[model samples]
Target: MEIDPDLQGSVESSHDPIPTVVAGPSGIRPSLYAASNTSASTSTTSFGIRDPWRVTPDFAPSVGSSSGRSVHRSDTWYPAVPSESRKFEILYIPDPSRAMMKKEAALNLGWTNRDITPAHFESIKHLTGLVYKTGRTKDRVKVLVTEWLWILLQMDLFENSEAFDVRFMQWQDFRAIILDPTNDIEGWNMLAKVDCIIGGIDYSVDHSGEGNSYHLNMDELARYESCVAQLASQTLFWPPIRLARQASMKWNTICHLQMIARLHGSYTPRTVRLSTGQDIPDDVVLKRSHSECAKHVILPTASRSRRTWEYLNAHTDKYEFWMAQEYVQSLDQIGEWRVFIVGGNVISVVHTYKTSDDGWKGTVTESFLTLDEIREIVEKEPTPIRPADLRRKIVNPESGAAPIRSRARDDFMGFVLTTWKHLVARETRDTGAKPSICLFCRVDVGIRIDMSGQAPPAYFVNEVERSPNTSIWLRFHDNTMGTLADTFAMVFKRWLMDIRNPYIL
Candidate 1:
């Protein structure tokens, strides 16, 4: 059933927190609009000057030589075409039947993992780093171009805003459904029943290559055909309907769950003004997109007749059986949820402070926790903890003690400085690069001393140093004015991106 019309006035839950893990004073960075304005020419543009795909009016002028002639001609370099390996998209499909199953069955059957996020879904923590590394517009082009065509093709795929046209199932749906994390094992096992497989099927780009020449490599296409052939030979493993239903129950439910997870993203409503100054929002409502009716069980005018026989017939298929959801625009509207699994490598380090100025203090407390300590805390406790708990166990956070002096703050800052030195030293020790630097100042000042009256330059305040000297008696102070967890979070996030496959150099 199409749910776009009835859910226009849906309201947000009052108790839910803001849908982002914002730090300090800022909100989560906003996601980009799925649609972008295209331009006629190719030229590199600066940030905020023009959209990534569009041409800008600003042009650079060439300088003349002493002879009053142009010295150098400006030429636009042609970017190389990207190989298909460098472009991919995360396709989504909704599976209501498997979502309805119990938690144990979900996990044991490989349905659900860590909290609510299914085992199949991977976290988006890697996206930012990947984008930064590749910066390829082809990734964007493939998704946007194909998606635009999918919108036009959906009309033919559906029958008059009712159920999916049984005979008109598209290969797009097959790709999406296979990628969805919530499909039931029994549902997949029943794939043999579908005419799409039994009938002579055409999924090759060659069939689609007549006009575009966007053909898959012969070796890759042969591998795909071979896999399909193997699956066909193993028909007993995934029999059609009745027999398959009985067989799927015998295997552990989690065993059927694939490593790939469902895409639980949503879309938000937005308006964009074109160069023509025309404003357009997502007003197109498609029946196949919404599932709110199934939530409320209130059939909409667009839904087909709720017939038992038809429901059962559709039950044999995955795409048609999904509960109707609503239409939205950007996927950013869907609140993200992550299931963090703990347990990783562990290391121990000691803070052998050489002097009193080697520690970091806070407004009330100080921290001596090393990165190894912090990583240990993250692994042991899956739930969120207060920033104060992450500090050195020596300081009493609840005491409400008076603030310390800037000198005391410097003394306590040793943990962070030493951690950075040790990390760089360990990682690139063989390169013969200098890794040690003054804690009070990141530069290799060479001399470390107690400068009682010395105050750092204004530029370093709230950054390299947080606590500024205010009074004579307060020689040591703490700067809990900012969240230390946030500082560490930024570092860890960057590290995660660097370590992932297809490493961003």
Candidate 2:
């Protein structure tokens, strides 16, 4: 983990702006890669060139240098972490009965022999043990955990695939099941069973149960059900094709649906390299011209328009239109924090940084570096450098790659946890007596620049997922023994605590 400062410097300076090739008057241009080589050959004197998409070295100030004050806007807020600590018993062992139940559930879903692989069974067993620790009955645990598997399977089947028509059909059927639970289609599939499990969970807390047993009140349960329904109805059912169609015909509806998807946790934003060295057209630039500039100028109508247009057109001709999803465009950073909250308390936090090549839409890996360390790492070797390539350089030898602890880091964690608390509170207030808006879920918050005052940057929630992948568990226990066992134990423990001691206003 001892990175040579020289190596870091070399990497930091290596990111030269990618040379772009604009189409000439003939409407043809050399390939971007070829133009890049030509540009490099022409500009040997320019050193320390950086990609516009890559975060600058000074983009993130050192955490220690921050004022340590929580900056709140009228639209933004953060929740304070609880001072008290409670220890709960953890169960790591998998049960045979639960394993059998999972197999049965899988079979009931029409999973063929080929579909129910050993890996899927292992996943079921692991997850079942986790949910069992929440003090649910064998049957209840099986249903809940099985539903998780079903959701994951469906996401894998449809979301990542190009078969839009099939996804749309399946989603329509799934939406029906969610909206009307009593529909008794003869061949009720796994998703149908998932709907039933979600709809039927007894949210009433069983006060008579022994320690570690937990249950949500009816209202709390309803809230969770609503989230599941929305996820299925909005996210799953609304195919990309439908979204595109709505964009033109029903812009507002599309925006609302996109918001729901973001709230329910869609994929993390990744940066997109639209086209390297492509010039913006004059008409496109003029379309974006400010009226104030035209008003201030005193030249004759024709000359003023011509000069102003030419001046504005000069920069447009050399620009690259690197773009991201709307949600990403709203944020200021390429990294986001995934904070795991249970019972309104932050249990764990991980920083995820996106690679540069994909814009804001690429895969991210957990980074254990502190804000300062992260700055150094990015300065040295900008991401979307592959994780495998950056691992050895970013990991700290002393902490064995555990997340670095610092005052700035703590403040950030507090800010995210607090923001989530406020968001849940607002949801509850708006909904009025619904099930808890979020009993146990992951909240993804993007770090955004704040210029409202002299305050430093702040975090803004980008998405909330009721059933986020528990992959953080794997990353947290990477160097530990029985990582899978630990993952199940911790997940169940938090879930149980969340139910038993539900967050209150």
Candidate 3:
């Protein structure tokens, strides 16, 4: 069956079954097809939990479908199965043994013993195992995995180093060494040597093993060097302030230019302007109230907050308020839902919340807490408490039991799925057929309490993370039920399979 050119970008389609066969490295194959109009049904169980997985019958047809109808915009969008012939299967591997082996290998490779901690090795192993299990050629896997490890190591060094100027200088030196081909074996530190080795490995992958002795032409080398230098310089000069108006613009421009030179793409959290119906670059912080913005303002020179409206008035252009009508705010609580989507389906949901008094604006926290403990605090505390102040034992979400099913939760999940589909349609319309945006991504939804308290809380799209951090899954390995690693493996395997298909690519 051929997809209608006009309808290709839309997520909705007619009742026709589009045969899709998914095959993965593990050899498990599954066949999926779009559901017929009559087959779609929505029914609620006695527990009041709506089955979001059930197909809804009111889905609109794609532009070129037999009905020739377009989907209608509503307060909440609904999911529709696409007729496109895309399928994928997932394959996952356990990591404890793999991490141990890699730790030994790093030691033999002259890595400092102190730098190779168990936690660090495990992190490396998880990423490497992900690449290996997804069926990358052995040589390619080694090179890519090692490069990732090296990047992580560099990040750790920059973060842990006491002297920022010293670390910046080292980064400059490292960038110079990487760009120079003939400067071999003079006086370099262990980190510099490791950087050189990583570069060599990357080149070897590109040349299919001939890169061991390969040297780039002067022009190509100059361009590569320039790109690295720009990235390093930008990082060195990034503003310490969270959301300074001019500083953010400068940093974003540099980042975009660097990505262009590196042949990569970058994304920022989406910021929609309600008045102009346009997307502008801005950051939104949801707390107790919109007026709370006064409490969070940073002075031009220091980290302390300044109370004078004169300060803001002095810099009107640099401090304009860009509002999103969809911004979710509540009187007692502020939180967001993290919905993980794999192969166009919502696989997992995590609710992160903080009380109004906590002072922290977002869902993310440096400290950890279990769902039960968090629930207890919410139930008992008359005022919000910071997560860091909690003294209870930490429990990873992976080991915790499934969240108690509820209609409200189901509705939130449905809203997230719908938002993703809408965003995907917009992306496709803007940038033709790009497979990268359709794969695994995370959607963050901010929750706002209904004023009337007659229905569930309203959900608003906060942002979407295309490349979410995967280290959190490692915490779920010890779960008696299905671990997060298992879910990730399945989803990642499927994503890899999708990319491998020439049609999808």
Candidate 4:
């Protein structure tokens, strides 16, 4: 049957099957929950504990806010199926087993069905098309989509990279087998591909406890995984034109990397240009991935419970692109930058830069700023000096070495403005997309979009360690160690050297 263009076709038009995992002897409890916690609101926020019986709409008390009503009320008994108005519906339930499973599954799963309206999915597709332009080639898109699903599965505990590697081939050899035909003979690559398809979201980690939070019960787990895998399986098998498109896109990324390197002098290339513009050649330039730039830097002193690096690294493929760029400048002008504390060690800085030739009128560049001397700036007082008078130095003490402050804060600001000008020029010529304002700085100095158009929920900045009081909170952590003087310098440095990339899915 011809499917509606709007429906992803993951779920068919057949009558909705009676959910197999019903409200046992307790009777049916209305679950207002969503399909996946893929809601953009929760995308950056912590996955806090949720109450299964709580009505989904009632939870929207505001972003960053979750209640303890569900906590202290341990004896509060919810019916098997609560009133639909105040319930969270998970996709499916286990067969009277896994009762110990946290009811968060209900909230996470319910959101997909209840929260993500058809309009939201359409917008996602529209945004995806806009950012990617021509869709990526079939092979590359498949690999990326496969990688993304694998990362998600890894998060949900279907199986991890290590397990998959052992079952299919050596972890190190897996990439080689997929890419090289001469070295691979047994067609293990094809078998590996099949494993990826079947395992999509249903894979599970065997361990238990809070760590077991990674795994969902079988019923709910299978639903989401099947959705993605089934969608992928419906496409025509590896079309020829798709391969060419993937090759072209990869080539484009590489070319952009090289061109940016030349402009910043991060590489040896003298100059390169697309039909639109030319590259800037300078030795002290920096190039970073989008992953590095959008990272939610969190400070350590703010919280004790945290996800360790080992845990995050387990899903590196999902987050390899998260990163940051550092710019060196005078230490005096830090207070002017918008700063936030994410955790004890992480400090988040945001700023924009104008091209070198024009005043602040040129294209603006946005980036995440990092610095070694961040603490000093956060603690010190502000100065009245202008940023244009500071001295500038492109080279630090040594390669792969962090920069130390050598001059007064005013001097650092001068250097920062100069470097920022260069960055603006480069970004304007590269990706034509620019923001009218720097979200971090809250300044109307650059190209920006009406964030209201996207209808972003209200964001609340909390001063204390308690969970956010709102349904969603955009947390920005400042990780730099420096005084107020140092903070200004780091802020200016970020303005000069920060890098920005497209958020194409």
Candidate 5:
């Protein structure tokens, strides 16, 4: 199922957070969009920048000249192609009566703290230090380009609504975030006075290759990042860019699931490597370690997997390395489920089917998740013994098989909830927060039921998303968006004020 329509879209482009761990061999930072926008020329300069941000208007930047200049700041950043001014969209204006301003009451929502974020930032510090240690010319250039792209992309997290798509990520509406710890009526009269504009950067550029290639190789980009962390501390307060990178990036999400599964003995696919074109003992599927979307994942078999790998390598926006996961084998049972969770409640559970139209690299189109499914995906869990009638064809979800659900839907929900709690607990043992603070997220799970009914059904979490994409299959657009909007409101509230107490949401 196409659980997340734009999941891989941000990753493929460099606008989203991408840790160095999955940067592949080149370690050359990513800064390009997907097929539709890859070659879009970022060849203009209308930034109207000031000081450190140079004001270069209407020309391609001359590359080699800015290298050795001992200037106070780095030179201006040119665009991949000339594009329009980056525009900001107001996603929501809060109703103050509905917002929680009290320090304790507002904090009741779970927000993540002291976990993947620290590790990721530390990785940035480590890699930049390691790269600059050589002090050679090329090393300096790459580090300069990498760090610049990283900062622009980080800021783009809020600016580009099409890329981020989540309403609350911008952090303008979080009232409780500014609460005084000891005040019982802290922030009783405080409501965010500004519109939550979903645009961070002054302008947008082709974040793809064209974008990364234009920056001057100077110390300015590196300095810019540190500048934001300290001066823009309020924006980075609790978790804004940190959450996007930690949860939105597929590789990071997989890492989170693996850790949770290991500590609790829960199920996740046995992740294996397939970029080398090694032999596949059984059926295996290719998944982007940092991207999302079922369309991007049209399952490739052992032999064809190599072909898909090659295709991604040729694309400037696509990653060179990805996970070749173990496919779930269904002797008789078949189908997939996308369980949507918001504000710590099960909003809807969807059942998906396979589609006939297929895309390049054998990535077949599947039925998208519809917003109409009622209650749990499955009405009941599978019986201990498999029903004889169900022992039919050997269907593979990797192939074009339609999804199935019954009683297992609730179990899947429970699985996600319990796992999230454990994840919060382990990550926040000393951070002082409860584990029930996750405001919005989605879990894509696969299930297997025995044909002979001898063994119990097995369900594995294929993916997790904090800023999940709401598919076009919605039946209630207005109510869904309204509820969905509130789902993440509290998170941004804490982030806006930089509140970190009474636990994880």
Candidate 6:
């Protein structure tokens, strides 16, 4: 079948049986099509837990239909099926003897980012696809990475990498392999071998009495620089653990207001403390300062933010930090930009937004924001900031009753571009630390066209992730460059070639 011309995922016809999955009692499994007028909307939010039950990658399934077979995961449409023949494939692994069955995945995944190209991509379209079988079958794993994963894992960089056995298993399965007591040996081996290990959203150490938390000795975890060569320990996390923390755990998120202050200006939402008489809107957003994702973030319909703040403050000894931030109205229904920087240069900016054929409901889909589109935002925006229509305000600008500060025209560099420029500068110039010492980084920024006459359009930094999730690497394009994946391949290849190559962006 052909993909729709528009950005959203759509089904032109339901006459044919597409290879989609169904959410059964045992989670998402292959099944026949439902053949109904059902569109989906994933639970992906700027902050909060993503319900994996509806974890549909291709598009959100109509889980609430009630009569349909079922709908599990946020976006669980297409599933990873085993192909008869495989060249570059992904091997869904089992903890105990998984290594005994297959060779170890090459540290560099055979090719660096530079090896990726359009010609290679076209040729491999039919050649490289996922192959997965459930039980003790000879072709059990040997699964192709391209099936369920987005561009990040499907990057031609991982060609034949799956033959060695590193694959994307669900959180529960993966957790058992790594954290389970029985498979500690294999887990230790991976920790010592893989270049880096970042526990995605689902990773967290279970706190029996108080639910699971992401405090994997985060404070004491060794720095990325120290754990490059060797990392292993039989006892859970041994040697130097190079696990990447989520954006929320980073310095800026923990102390957002102050971090913005250090930027010489705040390109973020107007944040304030409830105790300091910070104005709270009826539709306010409460941010969790110290955790991963917005685990405990509270979204209220009324302005009872003070109670939430007081509660967190009262139990400071037990909980993480909390902040009351003004909810910046979105430019699009789901407008969140994640800028992928490889060695300091912005290669791709992922735009995750909600799409719907029916307009009323839709699921979140991720795509890259091309350079041409980036230029259009500025070229298209009106010269004057439409403050009146941007958002409702409690204080009048002329009277200055609330006393608010805003960014100037020159200070803004569009939302996507601004994220990169400001983050690198803040980390290096302001913090006086080596900026982004990792192979790559992802800076998330939110954009809105609402603001005062002085600065009508505004962009704010949301996160600075050193080891961003692999999902950020989605299909990217450039009119000038035939295939941008090749560019990313080049960066990663250069780094893998020699860590001392000096372009350590």
lDDT of 3 by residue, 44-64 (tens): 111111334423422211212
Off by over 4 Å in 2: 1-196, 199-334, 345-347, 356-404, 433-438, 448-457, 468-505
In order, candidate lDDTs are: 0.22, 0.31, 0.31, 0.23, 0.33, 0.34
Which ten-residue region of model 3 has the weakest summed lDDT?
236-245
The sequence of per-residue lDDT tens digits that candidate 4 reaches over residues 255-344 is 443454455444212222211122222221122111111223222222323233443334333112222112122211211232222111
Candidate 5 lDDT, tens digit per residue, 245-288? 33433554566668888877766777754544555444566665
Q: Rank the candidates by TM-score, best first.
A: 6, 5, 3, 2, 4, 1
Q: What lDDT, from 0 to 1, does candidate 3 have?
A: 0.31
TM-score per candidate: 0.17, 0.32, 0.36, 0.19, 0.44, 0.44
lDDT of 5: 0.33
lDDT of 4: 0.23
Candidate 1 wrongly placed segments (more than 4 Å): 1-393, 397-409, 431-505
**How close to the true structure is residue 380 of candidate 2, measured as C-alpha lDDT?**
53
Q: What is the lDDT for 491 in model 2?
A: 33
Model 6: per-residue Cα lDDT at residue 478: 23
How close to the true structure is residue 4 of candidate 6, measured as C-alpha lDDT? 18
TM-score of 2: 0.32
Off by over 4 Å in 4: 1-227, 233-259, 263-505
